[model samples]
Target: MGQESLQAFQHQVGDVLLRHRSFLDVSSKYQESNGRVNRAITKAVTECGCLRIEAGCQPFEEAIALSEMKNRFDTHLTGHLCDHCLDTVKEELGKNLFYMTALCNLLDIKVEEVIEKESKKLSTLGIFNLR
Candidate 1:
């Protein structure tokens, strides 16, 4: 799509989301054009509070559970365009952010710093398997 057209489309999506901003704190609300955080946001919506995450699940485990649930939701949504209900977007998004932000705060790490470090490591390893 043309840049202007894309911008307009994004604006409309934002408008739709803004209309119901209170219902869910979805990824679309916080994501830039980049797809990374958007994935997290979509995940938050799909997770809908029952991430099957045990209380004992570590951060990595929690992240994985959230991602898996998100992938399932993507598959299901792709097959159909059913309307959204009480999807745990808010809870999942809140928790996803809370855990990582908290971890970073405790570790004295900025997200940018972490990303840069990992990017360098991946470059050194000559791998880009960032799934």
Candidate 2:
């Protein structure tokens, strides 16, 4: 999808959505939705055992070139999500996006513009775009 599609989605969210029109409500819901997304992932790891996170400090070498850094970093994720877990995670993510878009609409900001700016920043900063 293009930028217009994202703008259209934001507009549609603002126009058709009835509840949580207030900025406070939308922002709270956005935060809640984000927690739900995190909880969903946690469940996939703990309850379902479909995934495992073996996270630690990433090994880094100053001598390695920036272009070769991609191969050294690890996600630490052990397994892919099963079908049920994938669906649950996707649903939670969708809800998170809905609330995020709602918040953006409340703030009169375009999601596409935000994404574009972030993309540009990442492209320009490359490995220096830490976090």
Candidate 3:
């Protein structure tokens, strides 16, 4: 299902990608989409007051197994996105994904293939897959 969705999205992007067919245009739009996503999140926190970020250092202990680290990690996010913020964030993220798919289309890369390759790496490396 995921692979099919990615392929469909790629095809859709290719069909409508008239202005940004060139690598330079698509890449620039992709970068801009990334910034827009960040701005959307920032607005949710700063302007909407729907979410808060209390980021800090993550506590780690050598005695704990690497597998346990996942349970101990702190996202540092407080509260949830209200309806308005949620919709805005979702729209921005959709744009980001569209551009990402556009990039993949330009490079002849399959989004699902990349996802599967990363999934395999994570499974193979398990707890050792840092970042």
Q: Estimated TM-score per prediction?
A: 0.30, 0.92, 0.94
Q: Candidate 3: lDDT over CA atoms?
A: 0.91
Local distance difference test, each candidate: 0.43, 0.90, 0.91
| Candidate 2 lDDT for residue 61 | 100
Candidate ordering by lDDT (highest first): 3, 2, 1
Query: Candidate 2's error at 89, in angstroms?
Result: 0.8
> What is the full ranking by TM-score, best candidate first?
3, 2, 1
The Cα error of candidate 2 at residue 79, in Å, is: 0.8
Cand. 1 TM to true fold: 0.30
Clash count for candidate 1 is: 3
- Which regions in candidate 3 have their CA more than 4 angstroms from the true location? none
- By TM-score, the better pick of 2 and 3 is 3
lDDT of 2 by residue, 72-118 (tens): 99999999999999999999999998898988887788899889999
On a 0 to 1 TM-score scale, where does candidate 3 land against the true structure?
Answer: 0.94
Q: Candidate 3: minimum summed lDDT over ten consecutive residues — where?
A: 1-10
Residue-level lDDT of model 1, residues 40-121, one tens digit each, is 4455445543222223432334455543553433222322212342233344454455444344443445655666688788
